[model samples]
Target: MQTIWLTEAEWFAILRIGLGLWWLESWRHKDKKDWFAGGGIRWASGIADKHRWPFVRRGFDLVVKPRPRLMAYIVAYAELALGLGLVVGFLTPIALTASLVLSLIYLVLMIHDWAEQGQNLMMALISAVGLFGASWRSWALDDTFGLFLQ
Candidate 1:
């Protein structure tokens, strides 16, 4: 067989695996304790507090307001679900959609927090990666069914 460069879908699948691993590692790091005890939820709430924009902060506050502990649980679970799904390639469309939504929400909050916020750029990039990373082709279960976007 002749050498062949990776297809777009293949590249996306590779990206999916890497990103999924990154999220999984993050979830594992948070699994050591309850979210309220300086874990994932607390981390998410703390970041939310930094948002200075009224509507944005308000939105985050509504999700985890006055309850960092609860927020912790939600964040941890969400991360776990999204991370695991992406890593395992069980549900590429759903996993990628969830990742994109979460990242987009974070982007909005960050930009609202600071008129000159720089975090938004990073979030935007991550969202784009989820959208185009072609992650449904590689290590995912979607690949087994021949359901890649190709």
Candidate 2:
């Protein structure tokens, strides 16, 4: 924690902010109209339906299929919300944890898909680093407002 132009906390903050940007990019690149119209869910449904994992199939059917529209909105907006919260250092802990969980869910659902797994694993790892390092303590709204300061 001693040999850099930026301090340790600042480095952590950069990581946190970068992850936020990644989430934002994920949200931004989506076809919002198609997603809102159920295309995204439909695509996921197709994958889930043919998934080799029984649990994934069951979980998707149980949690998402019944409420496709709601789930679609939730997934789409959740990324946007996570990005905004993390980028601004507001509710960083909650945002990191939620993003970690979301990343895990994606990893599980996309098991055997190496490309997807790599991205999800990296996202989850970054979330863990930010959470454990208390990255919000620097360059964050949480720091300014004295939230989650220890």
Candidate 3:
């Protein structure tokens, strides 16, 4: 009997596509009024309140609270762009890096919430693996187009 195991590249490709679809779906479900208007501020404030780290709380209050609309737009568009990049395996490393950064931010802000923290931690791990394994070069536009080759 022969057992076949998927290669790391294959696993990473699956992960990339899955994560991309998750982000895309999340974006698709968002309501503009809730994401871009006062709702964003309220959500940020709730997260800041939940954060035990004073630095993170202060950062959210000082930075995020001041420009809720801008932050909302940045987050919404970034998710869409990252989703597209990851789904098409284009610039995978860059998309993964961005995912990692966003995951870390969420982890910090939601540390007090075990469920959210765990989810963000998992995302960060996935991003790290994809970035370090050079999965972008496998089954990706970067490979076909000869872009970002190390």
Task: Give all candidate RMSDs, comma-separated.
Answer: 4.1, 1.0, 2.6
Write down the TM-score of every candidate.
0.71, 0.96, 0.89
lDDT of 1 by residue, 1-150 (tens): 122687666666666766677667767876556555756555556666785666766776675667767666666677788778877887777777777776677666555456534544543455467557666766668878877673
lDDT, each prediction: 0.66, 0.92, 0.82
> Can you give the lDDT of residue 22 in candidate 3?
71
Best by lDDT: 2
Scored by TM-score, the top model is 2
lDDT of 1 at 129: 79
Q: Give the TM-score of candidate 2.
A: 0.96
lDDT of residue 15 for candidate 3: 84
- For 1-150, candidate 3 gives per-residue lDDT tens digits of 122577667777778878788778767888877888768667878889677788998898898888888889988888898889888999888899998898898788877789777668887888888788777756789878989874
- How would the candidate models be sorted by lDDT, starting from the highest? 2, 3, 1
Ten contiguous residues minimizing lDDT sum, candidate 2? 1-10
List the pairs of residues colliding in candidate 2.
none
| Cα displacement (Å) at residue 47, model 1 | 4.6
